[model samples]
Target: MAGDTKERILETALALFAQSGYLGTSMHDIAKELGITKGALYKHYASKQEILDSIVERMNKMDYERAEAYEMPETEPDGFAEAYLHTPIAKIRTYSMAQFDHWTKEPFSSNFRKMLTLEQYRDPKLAQLYHDYLATGPTKYMAAIFRKLTDSDDAAMQLALEFYGPMFLLYSVYDGANEKESVAPMLCAHIDRFIAKIESGYRKPHAEGA
Candidate 1:
């Protein structure tokens, strides 16, 4: 029963936070929504910030794991480009896209999205964590993968950005509130286009061991 209560509370809070901005929500709201006493809610989560922080932490851990799974192999092709195109980096794209879809489709996805937008201006600390995960961490990871695949000092980083950039932009514009079908095709098309671009960029010019 205690376990069920904890899960219920978290689920309810997640939905609430994603639907309404953190500032707009109160502990009382959560308690009222859950049909529980404020003290019972407090027992589950000490504060709203604490609950939000926990959700963000879980998201961070999932992202790190997602990226880590794409670690490039050591014996990859001379530039690492082949391995990247053939293996880990490809997997990363698939993984990220799936994660995006999951978040967008989940019951609390709206709340999650809402919290993401709200946190940037409402809390610097939360924003920093997001910056680290979405911007800094993924950018660095993609850059490394690109470096390996293209054999260019900065080409890899640029390629990584180019490849995944649209997915972010598309999500930013749509935000999953509506037009699910209109946005879905483009989300994948952008990835496919980037893959082709990367392949063209990485092809060896004038072969024979120059």
Candidate 2:
């Protein structure tokens, strides 16, 4: 089927892009990996740029599905903001750990993250994409959620940093190790401690502790 071929092409291109940075990978490489001619590859994507665009689009689609599966609150401005404030501390822990497992376990996500990590230094576009998905974007989204939960904008941003910082560090820790099992408990413990802090007294009496 045409759709199946197109999906295969995208997967092949993404794997190649991860192994070799986008600029380092030629259309020929993808075609060769797919056991197809360059012309055949062209039928699915107009250019290498098109292939990269498709990969990004696919990543976004997968990212949303992953978030939804984790029961993450919708990031956009709808009426779902209260979900962040009221969601149980235990469920929050579950969602947080689920996300940590996903990024580390999923080949597509881990490979895409590896590609971005490698290519961001060489490409401005990739650098922006890196920030949008892994860095500032998630921070801003969390901050917005925190803002609704707390009274102060500054506190919201700080809470976002506190919440995401361990998750970020654990990614590196996960990458450096071969086994995910060892790293998971560390994340689980960290999330538990963080949430416990939030629950204990993060908010001030007026607004202070958790």
Candidate 3:
């Protein structure tokens, strides 16, 4: 079927893109890998850029779906921290592990991540995608959630950094290995410290106070 062929082309292209830099992979390579002629590939994707665009679109949609599924507390500021903290550690761990698996284990996702990582430095669009995916997008979303609790952009951003920073570092070290078991505890520890800081009404000390 036409749909199946298009899907196959996309999957083959993703694998090739991950193995070779986006700039290095060509239409002929994708066509050959898919056991299709260049003209046949054109019927599905007019150009390599079109295929790349499709991949980015699909992955972004997945992210949007995940964000939509995440539930945020509706409690008051005084109770927000406690409510968020009371969420079972097992639930948090499961979410964290799911994210780890998404980036490391899922074939399409893993290849797409690697492709973006490989091409980010060379392409402006890819660079922006990398930043949006790994940093600004999640940070901004969390900042909005935290703002409901703190009512301060600075405080919200600080909390987002404290919470997501360790997880970002963990992603770098995670290679679909035993790193998950080793890092889950550290991730939970960071969460524990972050919650403790929030409960303590943490504030930056002035030079004079110091």
TM-score of each: 0.76, 0.88, 0.75
Judging by lDDT, tell me the better candidate of 1 and 2.
2
Residue by residue across 1-210, what tens digits does model 2's lDDT show?
999999889887887888888889999999999999999999989999998888889888987887678677775633455566556677788888877776778777777887888898999999998888788887887887777666788988898999998898898899998775799889988888888777765423323324
Clash count per candidate: 6, 11, 0
The prediction achieving the highest lDDT against the true structure is 2
lDDT of 3 by residue, 56-121 (tens): 888878765653455434455546544555555455555655666677678888898788789889
Off by over 4 Å in 2: 75-80, 202-210
Please report, as a residue range, the 10-residue window in candidate 3 with the lowest summed lDDT: 201-210
Q: Candidate 1 on 43-160: residue-level lDDT in tens? A: 9789988887777776667555644665634443345444555564467568657756755655654456556666667878757755664466657666776675555767777777
In candidate 1, position 121 carries an lDDT of: 73
Candidate 1 lDDT trough over 10 residues, lowest sum? 201-210
Better of 2 and 3 by TM-score: 2
RMSD of each: 4.4, 2.9, 6.3
Instruction: Give the C-alpha lDDT of model 2.
Output: 0.81
Global fold similarity of model 3 (TM-score)? 0.75
